[model samples]
Target: MTLVPYAGSSAPASASVAELRPRPKSYVSRIWRHGPNDGVPLFRIDAAIDPATIEDRALSAALAPFAAQLQDLSIYVLHAEEVKPLAPWAVGRLDVDEKSAHVFLHDYLAAPNGMLMLNLFQAPGAVADIVMGVAPMVVEPRRIHFAITDYDIGIRASIG
Candidate 1:
């Protein structure tokens, strides 16, 4: 079964989900609850959101201007992922098309600013620090995020 994203503006409110997911009555009144102070769950560390509307070529097109303005540097694309065969039961008909929907996907790019941005939208705070700590800081990147919004045929990009 294909799991689509939670399509809504805000998350569902509390009371409305009584039938769907019940919360303990004491949840409201109790200050001290019964739970373990476990560390954060292991989620995808390197995650990214791609332009919702643009395709591969358009994605490149939108970034062309930025690329030109950039100081010709080699960008390293790092992918943190796991690969496994598609399960027949969950694969469904679309599985034959061979596209699995995912939330996080990103590519590294070199920019003219002499600073590497974690991504187009927002760069991880430590990226610059990591780069600077290495040694001879020769090239820096000016990262940018070009917004893409239409997925029907292609994507539309915007500079936020």
Candidate 2:
């Protein structure tokens, strides 16, 4: 699976003028394969943003192509302050309505200085079982933690 960002240079209304401007940093794209001969390929794209900014529409546009292929979507707000409360809310929204979850995620991503990570999984069976098994932990305030780590590692190893 491949993720491609928008090629246009226009900035979203929420973004600052400086963010849309080009920078002098060198751009690099690399594909890395780990483990054995049949290892899964991991693609990493890094950019230097002077003042970290994320545009909601741009993110949504970039992900639109993969919407049909995705079986599960996980969004994490890495901000230390928000993670605690957001965990249960995320799980509840996901259980009730996935579209509403996406809407909330887009709004959160558009906020200034928002640190977020999104994981999209194509395989459903194993991942869905793993997610359901840990559904309780996702809602428990004291045990709020990402439940996909185990599934991610297992999938990578199995693919290899």
Candidate 3:
């Protein structure tokens, strides 16, 4: 799989923004929809986070259960401008579980500075519902302040 940017230039809002209204300032969530029918769910967390940080490991651990159930899991990193725009990088499909999730995270961690996008493909349920369960674990008290960037689920198949 390849990481595809959400094309909507304007900020799109969703129920998640309302639900997150009470939380601290950084818990912002951006929702984007792509695909002919907008059927896929791509969740992004934009934050001042270091991919190599230990907190990220915790997140992978949290998602271990879901990854096992999923046919494929991809984590993409888009470079966010603290000052200027930079190209984003993605670490494609990973084999995740309780034991190997930590290792897979390291590949993503190698990116210098970027937003995190977690894409779950071939999942069996509703997109919105799955994201609701995922949004909470993405936040941390001090390590990183996560902003949900987009929910657009458009991805390109990797060509060999």
- Report the lDDT tens digits of candidate 3 across residue range 40-81: 222332222122332335544433344432322233333232
Clashing pairs counted in every model = 10, 0, 3
What's the lDDT of the predicted structure labeled candidate 1? 0.21
Q: List, residue by residue over 1-160, the lDDT tens digit for candidate 1.
A: 2112222333333332111011111101112334686322122222222223223343333333343332222212223222221221111000000122121112112223212222322322222111100000111122322111111111123534
**Residue 142 in candidate 2, Cα distance off native in Å:** 27
**Per-model TM-score versus the true fold:** 0.16, 0.19, 0.18
Error of 2 at 123 (Å): 17
Model 2 per-residue lDDT at 97: 26
RMSD of 2: 19.6
Global lDDT scores for all candidate models? 0.21, 0.24, 0.27
**CA error at residue 150 for candidate 3, angstroms:** 2.1
User: Tens digit of lDDT per residue, candidate 2, span 74-120?
Assistant: 33322223223323223211211223121012123234532212232
| Model 3 score (lDDT) | 0.27
Residue range with the least summed lDDT across 10 consecutive positions in model 2: 148-157
The collision pairs in model 1 are: 53-149, 53-150, 53-151, 53-155, 54-155, 114-140, 114-141, 115-140, 115-141, 120-145
Candidate 2 positional error at 63, Å: 23
Enumerate residue pairs that collide in model 3.
30-148, 32-151, 32-152
| Residue ranges of candidate 3 with Cα displaced over 4 Å | 1-55, 72-134, 137-148, 151-160
